[model samples]
Target: MTDSRFSCVLFDLDGTLVDTAPDLTGALNHVLSQHNLAPFSVQKVRNTVGFGARITIERSFAHYGKTLSEDALDLAHAQFLAHYSENICKNSTLFPGVDTVLEDFKSNGIRMSVCTNKTENLSLDLLEQIGVSHYFSSICGSDTVPNKKPHPDHIFSAINRAGGITEESILIGDSMADVESARAAGIPVIVMRYGYTAIPSDELGADLVLDAFSQIPQALRDLSH
Candidate 1:
């Protein structure tokens, strides 16, 4: 295996590391059902992700041409979370090549962390349920940091919490939020072409654009040069 260029690698949990849209869409549909609204398909819901559960709830509701009041949104958010937590891992799986890539990093003495917009406890629960929690030295979420992604603090906090230095750190993610955050934080970022995003992954302007997780080690090697 090729050596990694970074001392620390921070991954965005949902799209970058795991394919979580199935369960997330299931949770969203459960909430919509309670309100007698139409449910969204997994493909449609994929682009709505990356912000957080509350935003997901909002976007799903808007899809039905319904605007939710703050109180209604709060209720829907609570309902979505309850249903989601119960079935968080029912269909979630690590992306192809994730395990091998993680193993390579581990064996190479590179530190790793999960930096996600999901809530802290939920991110922890999902990571554990998906059986990859042990690979990460730190798992930071939107709620765990002072600010969420698109704000550099989310990246900084995740790296710092993992005892990683900014100079030797890199981010792997699938969204514009990740690009903006890493750029603002002054670090290189790699984006996955197969991840969930409203914008095209290649158009996201990352340092590297990968078609599969297996491409990561080679990409890291290229970046190091």
Candidate 2:
């Protein structure tokens, strides 16, 4: 295999690499049902993802025209986390072509890592259950760094953990957080068209906006030139 132009490839976990909305929605609905609230469909929940479970829980509460006190919110978050951890991969699956793309990256000698807004332990659990944990040299989450995405420290932490340098790294993600984080870190970012975001991918102002997971390696090759 030939060496790749990029030494390190950083990915955002939830929307970029995996279609986790189904299981996320399942856990969310479980929490909502506990409070006797109506459940949101997976399609509806997709827009609420990317920020992490707490935010998703908060959004769900807001949707029901209710507000939670700090302590209540914390308890709800705990419930969501516990349930999600147990059912992490119940319906979660990698996006089409993810395994192939990851294999291509590995064969080309590129180091890879995951940087996500999900909690560290949960992220690890999900990745492990999804069967792609072996591909990432490092997998960092919201609790892994002092600051989460939109803050450069998260990206830096992931790169450092993966033994990667910023100058030779690039980010592939599907949200404003990813775009902003990569920009703050002074790295190129690619946004996937189909991801869990309210805003369109093209509107996120990424270096490249791709429509399919299969297009990533070629997109990176194009960026390298």
Considering summed lDDT, which 10 consecutive residues are worst modelled in model 1? 1-10
Question: TM-scores across all candidates?
Answer: 0.97, 0.96
lDDT of 1 by residue, 1-225 (tens): 555558999999989999999999999999999999888899987899988889888877877788999999999999999999999999999999999989888988888999999998999999888888998999999999889998999999999888898998999999998999999999999999999999989899999999999998888888988
What lDDT score is found at residue 68 in candidate 2?
A: 94
Error of 2 at 221 (Å): 1.1
Those runs of model 2 whose alpha carbons end farther than 4 Å from true positions after fitting are 1-4
| lDDT score for candidate 2 against the true structure | 0.90
By summed lDDT, the worst window of 10 consecutive residues in model 2 runs over 1-10
